[model samples]
Target: MGIEIEQKILGHARDAHPHECCGLLLGRGGRIEQIRPAANVHREPATHFEIDPQALLDAHRAARDGGPQVLGYYHSHPTTLPEPSATDRARAAGDGSIWAIVGEGRVTWWRDEKDGFAPLPYALRDG
Candidate 1:
């Protein structure tokens, strides 16, 4: 992940303070190159986050059109630690995609594994 990307994620989190923000990460080979902010359509956005379905669709379509791969998804915790909550685990599909959680002035990455979300180490590239 580039430091710039990480900062953007945090900025989104701050902009949505008191509510959970959500978005998609576009990149390749374990590096995030872009951040796409998606509308949080969850009924209770303060505690839950549901990325707008259309955003997901557009991402896939762009991939088919030679855009960056759907590297992963990102969301904020609002008041909790920058880690996946139980709800996150339940919603995960175990597809081994990256998951970035932003909160508490930090951004953490995880790998959605078949068993669970494993913490992922990342290096920030100068941007």
Candidate 2:
């Protein structure tokens, strides 16, 4: 992740405040080129998030058209640590997508694996 993207995630979390913010991680290889903020359409926005299906579909379509790859997803925890919560673990598809969880003034990365989420260390690359 780039420092700018990290800042944006934190900012999104702050802006969402009581509700969780969700979005897409867009890029290729080891670089994240953009963050697309998506509407959290979950019924209980305060505790969970469901990225608008349209946003996901659009991202895939764009990727097929030579846009950035759909690297993974991101969401905020609001009141918890930046680690994956039980709810997160349960919802993960284990498709090896990267997940960035923002909370408590920090951000943590994880790789959703078949067993569970594994901590993923990332360096902030200069943009």
Candidate 3:
């Protein structure tokens, strides 16, 4: 529910533009520490995303040193809806982390809270 965190997330997602921007959320208990951008690569069009290994490792280390790390992850959906697609569902990683869907212009975010990836009510959140 803060401007600074929201702006960071939006800025990262926006920076990706047409391509999906992948990253990790670091923080603890509603306190987002950082939004570290990772590899946001797709096999092609209408496909799922794959984070680069090197980028992932770096992110993990960043989270370790930064703060409560591995809060969640983010990626843009480009021309698709905010909802998860079949590919997304299939590729879903049940790490109990949040997932952000950045549409062409709009943005939708979800979080894994025990049950599943539920839509998160937009609010001032960290990580």
Candidate 4:
């Protein structure tokens, strides 16, 4: 992930404080090149998030047209740790996508594997 990208994630989290902010992580391979912020359409935004379906569709379409790939998803945990919550685990599709959770002044990455979410380590780089 780029340092700027990380900053944007943190900033988004801060801006949406008390309500979960969500977005798509766009890039190729292992680098996150951009973040496409989306509306959280969940009924209970304060503790949960649901990225707007239209946003997901548009991202996939863009990727097919040679735009940045949808590398993963990101969301903020308003009052919890950066780790995945029970609700997150229950909703995960086990699709092997990267997930970035932000909270308490930090961000943590995880891989949604078939079995479960595994902690992932990432290094920030300058663009």
For lDDT, the strongest prediction is 4
What is the C-alpha lDDT profile of model 1 across 8-114, one tens digit per residue?
A: 99999999989999999998766789999999999999999999999999999998898888989999999999999999999999998999998899999999999
- The better-scoring model by lDDT among 1 and 4 is 4
Can you write out model 3's per-residue Cα lDDT over 1-127, one digit (the tens) per residue?
A: 4556557667776777666667776667865556667776667623456777787777678667864667777776766787777776766776667777767566577875555567887666443
Lowest-lDDT window of 10 residues in candidate 4?
A: 29-38
Q: Which segments of model 1 are wrong by more than 4 Å?
A: none
lDDT of 4 by residue, 1-109 (tens): 7899989999999999899999999999868899999999999999999999999999999999999999899999989999999999999999988999998989999
Model 3: colliding residue pairs: 1-124, 1-125, 27-68, 32-126, 32-127
lDDT values of the candidates?
0.93, 0.93, 0.68, 0.94
User: What TM-score does structure 3 among the candidates reach?
Assistant: 0.75
- Reference-based TM-score of each model: 0.97, 0.97, 0.75, 0.97
Candidate 3 deviation (Cα RMSD) = 3.1
Error at 48, model 4, angstroms: 0.5
Residue 6, candidate 3: Cα error in Å is 2.8
Backbone clash count, each prediction separately: 0, 0, 5, 0
Model 1 TM-score (2 dp): 0.97
